[model samples]
Each structure stands twice: as C-alpha cells, then as structure tokens.
Target chain A: MPNYPKGERRRAEILEAAFDAFGTVGYRNASMVQIAADCGVSRAGLLHHFPTKESLLEAVLKQRDRIDNEQFFAGGTSDDGLDYLTRMVRLVEHNAAHPGIVSLFAVLSSEASDPGHPAHVYFQERYARSRSWLRRAFRDLEQRGMLRPHVQPDGLDVEFLSLLDGLQVQWLLQPDAVDMPARVRAFLSRVLTEVA
Target chain B: MPNYPKGERRRAEILEAAFDAFGTVGYRNASMVQIAADCGVSRAGLLHHFPTKESLLEAVLKQRDRIDNEQFFAGGTSDDGLDYLTRMVRLVEHNAAHPGIVSLFAVLSSEASDPGHPAHVYFQERYARSRSWLRRAFRDLEQRGMLRPHVQPDGLDVEFLSLLDGLQVQWLLQPDAVDMPARVRAFLSRVLTEVA
Candidate 1:
C-alpha cells in the first residue's frame, strides 16, 4: 500500500507553506510554484495534494477555523452568554500573539468580497454562521437582561463581528496603537451590563 | 499646449478604469494591460500617465481620499463633536450607495497590512491620521460632557474606526443584511450621550 502517513505529512507541510504565503503576499500574489518550492515539493506534487490554489486556500482556511473553534470552545461550547463573550476576548488576545493568523483572515475575507472570487461564497456563508452564533450569545444575554437598553438586537451581531474583523486590520497595520483585546472588551462593556 | 485638456481627460478615464478593476479583483490580481484596454488606451499610453502600477494605485487612493474628505467636510471641518459624528453617519450612508468605494477600501486596507505591500505606509499613516481626527472628536464630546461614563478614552478612536472598517466587509458580502449607516449611528449612540 501507499505510504498514507507520509502523504498526510506532506499535505500538512504544503498547507503550512501556503498559509504563510497567502498571509504575507495575499492569495492573488502568492504563487503555487513558489509555495511548492518553499515546502520542498515539486509543482506536480503540490498539485497532487491541493489540486489547485483555491483548494489549497480552502484547506488553509478550514485549518484556521478548526484551530479557532478549538480555542474558543475549549470547554465544549458554553451556553452562558457572558462566558461566550469572555472566550471571545481571550480569542482576540490569542490572535494578537499570532499576526499571521490575523493577516490571513483579514486578507482573504476582504479579497473574497468580490463576487467573482473563488472564496466569495465561503466568506458569505462564514459570516452568516458567525452572526448566527453571535445571535445565540446575544439572545442569552437578552434573556438574562444583561444587554444594555441602548444596544439594539437587530444589528448587534453584524456590529460585533465587524468590530472584531475590523480590529484585526488595524492591529495588523499598527499593533502598538491597537490593543485588540482591550478594544473588544471595551465594546462588550458598552453593550452588556455585566462583562463577566 | 499639446492638448493638455485631452491628456487630463485621458488620465481621469484611466483612473476610473483602474479604480473599478482594483475594487473588483483587488490590486494583486488586476492586470495593468486589462485596465488599459478597459479605458480604450494602448498599454504604452496608459504607462505614460501612470508610469507604474504602484503609481496608479497611489493616484486612485488619493482620489478616493479627496472625494471622502470633500463629502465629510463639505461644511469646512466641523469642530462640533456631534456634528462630526452626524457627518460620519452621512458618509456611511453615502458609501452604501457606492459599493465600489467600500470594496476598494476594504480590499486594499487589509491587503496593505503586509509590511512589504506598496501601500503599507499609506494605510498606516492614513489610520493614524484617522485616529487623530477621531481623537479630536472624542475630546470635543468629553469637553461637552456628552461622553458616556463607561466609555474609556484610551482606545475609543481605534474601536470606532475598527467598527466602521469592519462593517464594510460584511455589508459588501451581504448588503441586505447590513445597514452600514444605521450600525454606525447605533455605535455612536452608545459612546455619545447624544448622537445628534
């Protein structure tokens, strides 16, 4: 039989190379051939693993999400709204330590806004899913009467997600000027009566 | 006078074409030759006006800034904190009608986060200037005793700008789901006692 373990290892290596390349130069500018060279694989071998740049991008994005979900839901998905938000702040703090992860999401999500982009549908659905999750958290807060009177439930999901996404770009550009966790906590404080 | 007016017209046409391409496909994927063709100019002719892709990007960015400033400061730079925020909401309203501008900023700003990107310094300084301007507004509100008690002064500028920048990506992805101006107004209401 073929060496399954070796094949998986090689695939992971290619993904690591692509993740870094996409984060650094962006998806459009990152070349598959260069990514192959970076990972000590032939172009054909890289294609064998990824099939295409879009496929490679998809794999990288999925990997990022897996890591993020693991970190954010380390306790296996807390239903407590305050606990959820506390986890979000910790996640943002985690992101601050890893600029590469922040850069990848910022670059890809913005690039994917073009209707013709390969990842266009992916990001659209991703944001929808994110909003739904946040909606649950906000609903929990509302039931507990923790949501501030001024905070409208209608657009809070979009606003909170936007705040998180937008903070990444600013933090990437000027890390010294932006404290991502602090900003996120500040926003949470304004929206919720008890931040936890 | 070698047809100076005609040359200026040609330059404007090129700028418009480049703007659309950059917004749609982003800077890295947009082909210079395609942009020239879109504007009905020869590649060499396009180069005569903008010697390089980076130069064209700079011109397009400057034009965007000029338009934004004109729209935001139509009243000659309002020092009134509430008036400034009202103008900002109006600007977000203006942006909703023009998706191209929003796309361009969202795509470029995130892409420009890479330190090696040509517009890296431009966006870095732009955000700095933005934060400084926001700082002035928050300071004015503080002086007027209109700032909320919970609003921390340290990173409000970054948080507000992050919200605006972050909202654009979501709006561009799902326009019907995001009311950019309303979200901006809502966030402002939380920070300021009176949003005007």
Candidate 2:
C-alpha cells in the first residue's frame, strides 16, 4: 500500500482545490468557502491545514514554483540549449493544457508587488533565481562555442531569460497567435548555430 | 503666451498628476484626493473633468497608451515595417527611461482582466491590435523575402510581439539583472539577421 500520510493527501487535495478556485475566480475574488467546498472539507478543516487564506494562496503558489523549477528551470543543456528550449516550449504547452494554474500565476504575479503580500517574496526570489540560473546555463553554452563569436552584454543569457519570460506573457494572452515551441526553436537556431 | 483654455490646461494638468499618482501608487492604491493635490485642484474640480474614478483611470491609461504608441509602438522600419526591428529596440529603450508608466501597466494589465474591470476591454483590444499589427508587418516582410523563407506560425510577427510583451514583465521585475534595452536589442538582432 502507498505510505503517504492521510493528512498529507488531504492537504494536497485542499491545495489542488485552491488552485482550481483561484484559477476560475482569481485570488481576490475567490472565497475560501468555495475552495473548502471543492475539497469536500469544512471551512474550519481547511483552515486547520492552511491557517489563513493568505497561507493557502502562498502554498498553492509554492506548489507551482516547485513544478516550474522541476520542469524547465532545473536542468542545463550543452548543445546550444536546444533541449532547454524544447523543455520550455513543452512547459508552455502543458500550461495551456492546464490553464487554470497559469491564470493563478498571472493574477498572483501582478498582485505580488506589495512587499507585504504573501507572494511578493516568492516572485521576487523567483525572478532573481530564474535569471541567475538561466544566465549560468547560457554561459556554459557560450563557453562550448555554440553562440556566435563576440556576442556582447556579458553573454546572451539576459536576453534568453527575458525572451523566455516575454514569450510566456504573449502565449498566455494570445495562444493562437504564437506557437511558443517554434518561436524558441527559430530564435535558438539562428543564435546558437555552430561557427561554420 | 501659450493660448490654452482653462479647461484644456486643467485637463492636461489632471492627466499629468494622474500619471504620477498612478505610476507611483498603482491603479488600486492611488486616490482621487492624491491626484487632486498633485494637480493643485479641488477633488470636486477633478471629478468635473473626469466623472468617476474609472473614467479618470481610463483617461490616464489612454494618455499613456497614446504616448507609448507614438513613441514606441509605432516603430516600423518603413510604413511597411522594414525598420520594425530597430523601432522595437527604440521602444525598449524608451520604456526603460520611464519605468513608472511601465510599472503601472504591469499592475493594471492583470487587474484589468476582471471582465467588468475598467481597463479590461482596453487590454483585450490592445493585445489583439498589437499582435495583429505585428503579424501584418511580418507578412509584408515575408512577402518581400526580408525574413527567412521557412518562418512558420504566421511568420515572425507573432513571435516578435510575444517577445516584446514577455520582456516587459522581466524588465519590470528585475531592472538591473535584465538590461531591458540591451537584451531586447540583442534578441532582435539575433532573430532578424539578414545574413544573405
């Protein structure tokens, strides 16, 4: 039999419910009651697990951060980051399949500017870490002679990270307009080509 | 002497104040009282120019949009967009100079997604129009054989538009780590190379 704790299973269920509720109604508009109802738990029981509405929101956000890192941000690519590009494109494709979570991040990322907001720190750290990690990956790629010779701005890492982020906003807003996978492939192919 | 009317000057002054207030405090946290103080007008006077908070907010957004479009969004290489790449680089540089307005858009674009929200329709149309403009521009480029022959998913316009939107989010979050203008320029250069 599976050894997962019953409480842990219930907590996961509550977080999933929160994700769905926030996806539909957004963070500010979604009620704790609806989330608890979705989980088939009493409001008090949900509170026992999350303590506060803000905590529940934070937990959901943390869950997404974990998944994003695991999927796109965790690994490195040697051959001009084509693998990373593919992973990122697939990540976007997955995000489109489960758009509720994407909406949650869109809503929370905007509101997270309030330093006291629960998600403020998470997003702040996320942007910082994502930029740094992607920078390192690009550096490793450049050192392997994948990038065109004498590219500036300390490497193409900053541009790559920005383009990755910028493409997500466009894809989320107008999926029909952009095939995220192809766009990444096109840019990487041009920039990451071996010196002939 | 400058021959502007009291009403015209007051309207202009209110917009200026609204820009500063909204830019600093964001759409939600900014107040009419603060806007009135900034313009040296009575709260009642401000309302006479703009009947409601929503009206004022919309007007402010419109003005900022106008400035951005005139200054940045209109960056086509020719009327047919030969200079679109260079023009977009200019836009990013301009945005970096006026981060206050950029921050306002970042906050409001997401807030404006509430169906009934003041800027909701504006953002919806804005995204559509921006993407459309880019697509048409790229279509022209493709027709003229300016872009690579095999560009797909409606060619470079869709991806170009997405990159601009996506880069803005990262630039807003991390100004130093991601040099917005430089990164955007590098990205444009890589994707738009005509190395024939």
Indicate which candidate wins on DockQ.
1
Off by over 4 Å in 2: A1-10, A20-46, A69-82, A113-118, A148-155, A194-196, B1-47, B72-80, B113-118, B139-153, B194-196
Q: RMSD in angstroms, all models?
A: 2.6, 4.7
Shift in Å, residue A103, candidate 2: 1.8
Question: Candidate 1 — which pairs collide?
Answer: none
- How does residue B164 of candidate 2 score in lDDT? 61
Judge candidate 1 at residue B194 and give its lDDT: 84
Looking at candidate 1 chain B, the ten consecutive residues that score lowest on lDDT are: B1-10
DockQ of each: 0.83, 0.34
TM-score winner: 1
For residues B130-176, write the lDDT of model 2, one tens digit per residue: 77777776666667767644334254665566566556666666566
Q: Evaluate all candidate structures by whole-model CA lDDT and list the values in order.
A: 0.90, 0.67
Q: Which 10 consecutive positions of candidate 2 chain A have the poorest summed lDDT?
A: A149-158
The native-contact fractions of the candidates, in order shown, are: 0.90, 0.34
**Tens digit of per-residue lDDT, candidate 2, span A1-196:** 2466988888999999998766544566568888889889988889899989989888888798788777765565444444655666677667766656666776566556545556676777887776666566566667777666535436365555555555555555556665666666666665655311
Q: Clash pairs of candidate 2? A: A166-B166, A166-B167, B77-B83, B77-B84
